[model samples]
Target: MHVVVVTKNTPDTAATVTVKGDGTIDWGDSLVVNPWDEYAITEAVLLKEAHSGKATVLTVGTDEHQEALKHGLAIGCDQAIRVWDGALDGCDSLGYAEAVAAAIRKLGDVDLVIFGRELADIATDQHVYQVARKLGWTMLGYVAKIQALDVAARSITVNRLTEYGTQTVRSTLPAVISVVKDINEPKYPTFIGIRKAAKAEIPVWSAADLGLDAAALQPRTQQLRYQELPKREGTVEIIEGATAQEKAAKLIDRLIEEKVL
Candidate 1:
């Protein structure tokens, strides 16, 4: 089995967010490799361990992306590929999907493509589905558990978590799966893994290498402006009464005053 895991370089959630004068986040001091992509990497490693296959991790970003890629290798991916270029700086979910699909095509003979349910920077769960559409592959989203992989039959059976409950579905090989947070716990890098990852050579790719058109794949989403969240404030008032009916009436009056009723 040849598994390809799609990872991302995201801003650290622990870092204090600073808004610039223009209202966009100041990422100069922010850390990278947010948790969501780690889940994808962890799942891929587990799959490889179960089926005895090689796992490769890929990311779309600049040379700085290597930090996160190295982290993936340290976590357990067999190899790493970095897609970087000036043209890919502000690409949105759709553009990223196109670039990733092109890279996967170049990889050849990929059995499974896995990605985190969403990216922390964008918080959009659209890339995996878009890539699946472009590649004409079956896609499963919000997968919480992978029950079995029938190698002989070339199918995968997984349980997806939804608002209603868990739904088990089976799909043929060469499919794309977007994993949720509950899928599995990501493993920390071991001493040996870190040393191996440090020595691994990460290959870099450009738009031309991936057969992508920078102009045609420009971002469709426009950032008109970014704004800081409003500060929260409230006052607590306790209503004490002898009777339950009186307390209820007072609460209704307060709601009416606040125009929430």
Candidate 2:
């Protein structure tokens, strides 16, 4: 299958992510793989098992992103690759699409590219469509299940979730697909796998390696500014009464006095 899955390191779902007073995001020390990408990695591994092919996971970021690649390696990906450059700072979805599309092209023989529905950190999924567009490949988003794969015919049939309902459609191979967590339960990395991934050497590709220049890394979309809203303050009151009826009466009276009744 030679499936290539994209993943990212993001704040842990349970972490309290907030914008600091300096305008930078504070994710604390807890970071993990994008929760949605778990299913994507699992799907890649499953595809490799079913088709006796390789599953390679790729990402774009700094050294901090290696954690995500290691997780993919532990999850059964045959290889892990990362791309980044100083110039890529402040890069938006369009710039990422440029880098990712170029990297995929450099690989030359990727049959399928998969992704999580969205990135947890960015809370946006535009890169998925942008990457597909840059590659001029068919994009199947919100895939619930991969129904069939015909390597001989170079076709794939998948059941994808639509706003209307689940719809099954077939498309040619060498395409892009975005999956949801419901597609499959991701397997936890085993002790052996974790140790191996910890030792695995992941190659980092630079913008030049992907034939990208500083101009390409420039963000097409800009975020002018953002400010956190002040926290609203409130107080809690305990209503006390000797009986339920008394309590109800008091609650009603309070509500009427507060003009909320």
Winning model by lDDT: 2
Clashes found in each candidate (C-alpha, N, C closer than 3 A): 0, 0
Tens-digit lDDT string for candidate 2 (1-261): 689999989988887666777777666868799999999999999999899999999998988889989999997999999998887889999899999999999999899999999998779999999999999999999999999988778999999999999999999988999999779989889999999999999999998888897887788788764467777777767889999999999999999999998
Q: Please provide TM-scores, in order, for all candidate models, with all chains considered together.
A: 0.89, 0.87
Error of 2 at 118 (Å): 0.2
lDDT per residue as tens, model 1, 116-230:
8887876778888999998999999889889998766899999998899999999998899989888888888999999999999988989989879877579999777667788
After superposition, the stretches of candidate 1 with alpha carbons farther than 4 Å from their true spots are 236-261
Give the CA lDDT, 0 to 100, for residue 165 in model 2: 97
Q: lDDT of each model, Cα atoms only? A: 0.87, 0.91
**Alpha-carbon deviation at 9 in model 2, angstroms:** 0.1
Instruction: Kindly report which residue stretches of model 2 are placed more than 4 angstroms away from their true locations once superposed.
Output: 224-226, 229-261
